[model samples]
Target: MSLFHFSIRIKSSRLCLLNIKVYFCFALAICLLGIKAEVRANDRYEIVINTGVSEKALSVNSLRSIFSMHLKTWSDGTKIRVFVFSDDDQLHQNFSKEKLNVFPYQLRSTWDRLVYSGTGQAPIKVNSTEEMLTKVATTPGAIGYLWRADINEKVNVLEIK
Candidate 1:
């Protein structure tokens, strides 16, 4: 081939390789973002309660008892006000199923029944973990759960059994 044709071919090949590399990098970035999103989605949480209330470590049963009004007062006689995340939230769903050993729908139905019957009041619902933490911190006799990563100094995190 002539010199000019050979140079053109080299430049064209280099451009094609560069385009392929860019596309590959873009695809890799997208995959990494997707993986990060999924990890965030399934992030686990630790249950936390107010300080100086119960020396007894919390468990699913204890949590249920407190939430369902079976256990109205803490060991110290502090009336418990349970704070809960929204029923439709994914984190709430996972936490309920994994930690609470109950489904969101079941919890909702239970709350509804309690509200309707005037037997007990359901826990106050917060839209997000941050809000739950904030409300739990500011409000006395409050208890709630949130993602471990979402915890901050605003609230006291109680150890669960």
Candidate 2:
């Protein structure tokens, strides 16, 4: 083949390879963004309280105290009944770590200390989010956490400050 033709073919082949690389990179970026969006969606949750509870908001410190079985009453003199799922539950773990800024194991130890020391009681444990919603909705002064998708009008969402 002529040198001019050979050079033109090489240039065309390189351009084709470059186009493939660009398309691959673009596809990879789109997949990564999709994964990140899914992660963000999974992380969503809410802290729910019984509608009877007067408080509409609470500091993160107060929430941590309540979960740790330290704060036993609301500001209005009513008992604050805290409910939670199992320590290994994903929602429970996320709530403990994200909202309370504590690990599930740490919360477990705190509850154990309170129980063993005769100074406090652990939060009520429910097996599922359905039970959590029902208990918190029916019980006065009840507080619990639930996935955002599981929340309904029966309970009031408490804003964390």
Candidate 3:
């Protein structure tokens, strides 16, 4: 009877340890999920360009010129081609207002006029930052904007002042 009681006590202790471990694992999982959700919430924009781009820091005016097709090349002789996110995207609205100093609607109307008049082509609109980054990375002379968190080794970042 004594031996049996000892064995039962050991089993109960083991069960208690197992329960503690399970609770620890559950808590850890919840913490990790919270961290991931917070990371996803802090959205920021990035300026991405082709590998060969020379201009590292561009003024708002210069960026505007490049996107508006007023400037065609860098000082190093690389041709410039700009890409833009769709009008509905937050990045597009923020970039237009903050960097381009224009409202999203006004910018779209101006781009349309430029396209229709044959004066300049509108920047190619991409659906997402990931798509923009992939295309800009692969295509020579391509430049686009994306969320900063989405930037990766595939594309080079340019500073917009």
Candidate 4:
């Protein structure tokens, strides 16, 4: 090949390599985003109770009853004070849907019916996750939901069987 053609071929080869590098970087970014999303999706919340409480594990049905205000006390007869975030809160909504198998609105309806009918009371609503963690960690007989990242050593995570 002539000198000019050789130089041209080298430039084209370099350009092709550069294009491949760009495509590879783009694919890597997409893969990383997918991985991040998967990890985030799996980072779910846990049902937490005060450290002083007696229970270590609870059945899903019983947990539902507690949040629904049907079960008022623990098995040991201590008053179970349930704490929750606002109905629209994402963590609260996820906990209600995933753990209780009910939507947040459904939980509100149940609490409202009980409260208005003079059968039971609603949960104590907090403003933020920080408040939730603090209240549940400090108060005796307190039960609430918290994101796994927000959980601290002061609170006990209740296992739902």
Candidate 5:
């Protein structure tokens, strides 16, 4: 082949490689941004309660007490019924750690102690997100945690201090 043609071919291949690099860099940047947003999504959970309850927010400690079944009644004298997912559930783990600053095992230990001691009761365990939403909606003064996306008009999102 002529030297001229050979040089042109080399240039074209170099251009193609450069294009691939640029494309990949753009893709990598987009992926990084998406990962940041996904992390925020992972943290998106809300403390929800039945609308009949008057309180709109709670301190983290009070929230912990409620979930641990030590706080049995809402301030308005409405019975505070607590709901939860099973200990092994991912949502349960996240909520326990992030919101309550406790592990699932710790919450479980507290609940078990409450139950066996006969002075208190454990929270109701819901099987799925749907069951959680339904129970919290139907039961007055009920409290539970749910992913923000699954939340609807049936319950009020309780703010945590």
Candidate 6:
């Protein structure tokens, strides 16, 4: 083949490879963005309280204390009923780590110690998410966690600061 033709072929081949690389990079970026969004979605949850509770918000420490069974009553003298799923539950694990800034194992240990020592009581454990919603909605001064998608008007989402 002529030198001119050979050079043209090489240039076109390089351009084609460059185009493929660009497309690959674009696809990778899209996949990464999708993964990041899914992770953020899975982490989304709300701290719900019974509508009768007077408090609309709580500090982070107060929330931790309530779940740890250290805080027994609300500011208005109403009993604080805390609900929880099993220690191994995904939602529980997420709440412990993200909201309470503690691992699930650590939270479980604290609850165990409280109950064993007779100094405190562990939070009420509900078997299913539906029951959690029902109990928290019907019970007075109840507090619990729910996936953002599962939240309804029956319970109030408490703000944590």
In order of listing, the candidates' clash counts read: 0, 0, 0, 0, 0, 0
Residue 149, candidate 3: alpha-carbon lDDT: 75
User: Could you give candidate 4's per-residue lDDT for residues 62-155 as a string of tens digits?
Assistant: 9999999999999899999999999877777777766788988899999999999999999999998889999999999999988888898989
Better-scoring candidate (lDDT), 1 or 4:
4
The CA lDDT at 96 in model 5 is 81
Q: Which of the predicted structures, 1 or 5, would earn the higher lDDT when compared with the native? A: 5
Q: Model 3: per-residue lDDT, tens digit, 1-161? A: 99999999999999999999999999999998875211223237777888877678889888887876778888788778888888867777777766677777887887789889998788787877677988899878888887777888888888877
After best superposition, candidate 4 residue 154: deviation in angstroms?
A: 0.9
Which pairs of residues collide in model 5? none
Model 6: residues with Cα > 4 Å off, grouped in runs: 1-43
Give the better candidate number (3 or 4) by TM-score. 4
Residue-wise C-alpha lDDT for candidate 6, range 1-161, written one tens digit per residue: 69999999999999999999999999999998875211344358999999999999899999999998899999999999999999878888778878898888988899899999899998999999899999999999999999988999999999997
> TM-scores of all models?
0.67, 0.74, 0.68, 0.73, 0.73, 0.74
Which pairs of residues collide in model 4?
none
Give the alpha-carbon lDDT of every model. Answer: 0.76, 0.91, 0.80, 0.89, 0.88, 0.91
Question: How well does model 1 score by local distance difference test?
Answer: 0.76
Distance (Å) between predicted and true CA of 28, model 6?
26
Clashing pairs in 2: none
Lowest summed lDDT across 10 adjacent residues in model 1 is found at 35-44
Indicate the residue-level lDDT of 38 in model 6: 16
| Model 1 TM-score (2 dp) | 0.67
Position 39, candidate 2: lDDT: 32
Model 3 worst lDDT window (10 residues): 34-43
Q: Could you tell me the lDDT of residue 68 within candidate 5?
A: 80
